[model samples]
Target: MRSYTADYVIVGAGTAGCVLANRLTEDPNIKVILVEAGERDRHPFIHVPAGFVRLLDHPTVTWRYHTQADAETSGRAILFPRGRGLGGSSAINGLLYVRPFAEDIDSWEQSGANGWNFGNCLPFYRRSETWTEGSSPQRGTHGPIQVSRVENPPEICGAVVQAAQKAGLQFVDDPNSDTRGPSIWYYQQTRDGRRRSSAARGYLRPAMGRSNLTVVTGLQVSRLEMNGTHVSGINGTTSADIPVQIRATREVILSAGVIGTPRLLEMSGIGDKDVLDNAGIKTRIALPGVGNNLQDHYVVRLGYRVRGAGTANERSHGLALAREMMRYVVSGTGVLTYSAAIVGGFAQTRLATRPDVQFVIAPGSFVAGRIGVLESEPGVSCGVWQMRPQSRGHVHLTSSEITAAPTIAPSYLSTELDRNTMVEGLKIGRRIFAQPEVARYIVDETVPGRQAETDEALLQYVRDNGSTVYHAVGTCRMGDDAMSVVDSEMRVRGTTGLRIVDGSVMPSITSTNTNATVLMLAERAADMIRLPMAEHAASTYSKESV
Candidate 1:
């Protein structure tokens, strides 16, 4: 067996892992090792902003975990694609950057996650961001991640923005600001013009050149090697099935994301005892919350057929492609650089205090599980997602063997509240499409058609075809409760020198995309871990004095 050692051993170099590696390795005295199950992020398509359609499902860059038979969707198994590379899901995401609402973070504090409220986390969010649209007090321009606006948006995208204004919603230039209710705005992407700016490209790539950081690819961590209540090391296998052990001098941080992190904990005998006993493994910790509280956003595509020449089909063929390519090559301004989802906004499905649904307007039809249906048809597609869902689910070990895939249960639409919200979101979508400004571009509804107008019909349609927005979180939730898997500082409960810093640690799901929040959490985790012992002592003394 091969053996290695480091001051910090980070499992799974995805979004969080990359950020942690970059921050921790900044100090030459701290030796950091980042292990990833997949190969390096060298694929060409991964750098293209619009190539996410293919990379989202590519097994080489994605973990490709599927959910168990969902109760709400008539036993349909949903595809959960997690990033398996150096940058994690950030490398293959839609790149719609959004911070959670203040209410969402306040809920985390209410759920026992101290020091994680919006007021406390706002600085961290700004710390990791580098917005191209210039600096604001709410946004940072010197951060590693580059966030920018779409240069040239489609006409329909603009119409949606107008429609949102006509609907009496606020139109804010920066949606991540303090004015955080409902708004219409141009989508912000993590791109430098046409090329993608992933966490690996922005953060990890620069840090990898340091002498103290070691990045190991194609290493699947099997279990945590613990001595009593303290974690000693991690055991795993290389791509060639070679056994290896990585001893951590200080800590073992699991940045393996929602699916992989909880799965690792369960495999290491730290989950619910009943689950471990069934898998024939000796119980060590028996934390029931290891794989509970699963949450994600589900979206139903609403497609429309255009009446005239204002669609992607007319702009994707022979002469059109040539003209656009020339313009794009000469001035870096064209439709090829960005995805069809140019304009999107948040809105309340009902007259509630908070926005419960989000809509993304794409100038192209994305159907058949992202195979891009109706490419030849002159139409646009709108995706409606029910945010802040009440439904919860779980993840569990399928077998004691490390090589076996874990069982995932997302339990989408498991609650009546979730169903009601989805149905209401569909109605809201119909209202937007029926508006005079938006109605001009549409000839007919190609998805559910005009027949499915009532609540029951919409509910049935949602149950049959709703798909995940690819934002899975809370499998290793952090809190002070008895069932909490990790604590507020991200340290695993009932253990020493073991921590989980990923989307899995989110006590509750954020109302927006999770990539930005995950990266920010990783940044905060790195800072917390890197604080000098003297500083920790001083801070503790100061708190006591207060």
Candidate 2:
């Protein structure tokens, strides 16, 4: 029966939600409430750089949703793991930081996001990062997120780099400098020393003590309270399952991610009329775009057993694990300090003008049947993914029950473009691994082995083994089109005092890991939200300062 109020009510304390909370609450006059479905990100593993392996599918810190059995996936249901709690997916994501190219943002501008060109987006990207490599004209200096350079580079990684060069790929200073290239580079990690610099840690945690911001965890929002199409407040249940209402005096922003955002919209009766009707709920808005245009990067791993190399597989057991633990405890640099993939490159398949495939090479392999568990012996892996997949699927409510996870289908390899590109990508990986510098380390090909050599076999391998790179987007696509759920500025269509600032707002997915892009988006959104408030506050400033 109790209700709460704030100038802004952010629905999820994930990447976007945390940024909004930190920026909006800068003004003491603005009261902000951040509601999260997971607990505070205090788990020890959440902070350790290499702790991502343990965090993936972690019941405590993740929303372990499973996709409806995708036919393209050999009828196997893929695990759709999303982060819960303060940092959201950023907390559990591999600490890889990649700035998307200006061309990528310009494409968004071309596609309908009017003011979101590379020129417009570059500032936000720079504003959100404090690159430890020092201030470059292209990189940021005094930003919240700390991007540490890869140090104590592993020899295997160097060999892989050499192999990429031997294959005629160029090594670039910045991956985001250009989109299509066969360039090898060290992963930019969002970390400082040994600790992970998740959005929660970088943005939200520092702002938690602010009087204007209130962050509540374990509050699973149920629905949006609408009055004549305007979102008046949100109805949710606390950790104790106590019903509560939180009203926003200014706006209600949904940063619940690509999956959670659209599902929450439909649950609140803000989606297609037919979808609402099927769910037995009256439609508040007939916006057909909600929960549609689902997209993701599907990757297939080519595992190779290693003989004379130190791989992460070995680091997970025996003296190797103990030594790394001690190394991290002392200096925070070791085998456990690297990103998800050690060295990745963007290469063009002969089928394309630009780089369509991303080669993610990791100095480790996973055991068969165990998704995240590392192999017992030394091994390496190269996961090839189509950066820009043409296949489109969707997320929709299955039942009226809030506890039920939405029906998610990424439609991986459903199109000719996706299928062909994946095959070419797999070939690219094989080529890179076959280079003499890198080939010497390989003992044998284990995954999809030498047997799956033909193009048809490769396609089948992708269908049976390809899974999400965890970069899901476009469900609440931002555009001027009728199919778009939100506009260029992230304002939800046909809704008042409501907006979505997350990866879901991306009109198209970026070529690399999405955290950097998401942060940039949220940073710009924060400025937009506070610009008017800042102007209003400016009037109250002393005349001398002005």
Clashes of each: 0, 0
lDDT agreement of model 1 with the native: 0.82
Question: lDDT of all predictions, in order shown?
Answer: 0.82, 0.85
Please write out the lDDT profile of model 1 over residues 1-546, one tens digit for every residue: 888887788998888999999998887767788889888889977887766877767868987777887668877877788888878888888878888888898899899998888888888888898988677778988888988888867787777677777776678888877485677777788887777888898889999888788899988899999999999889999888899898887789999988999889988899999888888778898798989999999888788887753766566667986887787678767766676377777888663668899887777774532324436667777788877988898888968987788888888898888898888877777777777777888888888778987889888888888888889999999899988999999999899999999999999899988888998899888878887633432211000100
Worst 10 residues of 2 by lDDT: 537-546
What does candidate 1 score on TM?
A: 0.94
C-alpha TM-score for every candidate: 0.94, 0.96
lDDT of 2 by residue, 1-546 (tens): 558887788999999999999988888888888899899999998898778888888888998887789778899998887999899999988898987656777888888888888788888888888988677667898888998777867688889999988987888766754444667776778998789999998999889888777888888999998998899889999878789888887789999999999989999998888888888777888889999989898888989998888888888799989999999899888987877887878889999887778877888898751248888989888888888888888998867889988889888888998899999888888888899998999889998799988999988888888778889998999899899998877888898999999999898888778899999999999998888785554222111100
Error of 2 at 387 (Å): 0.8
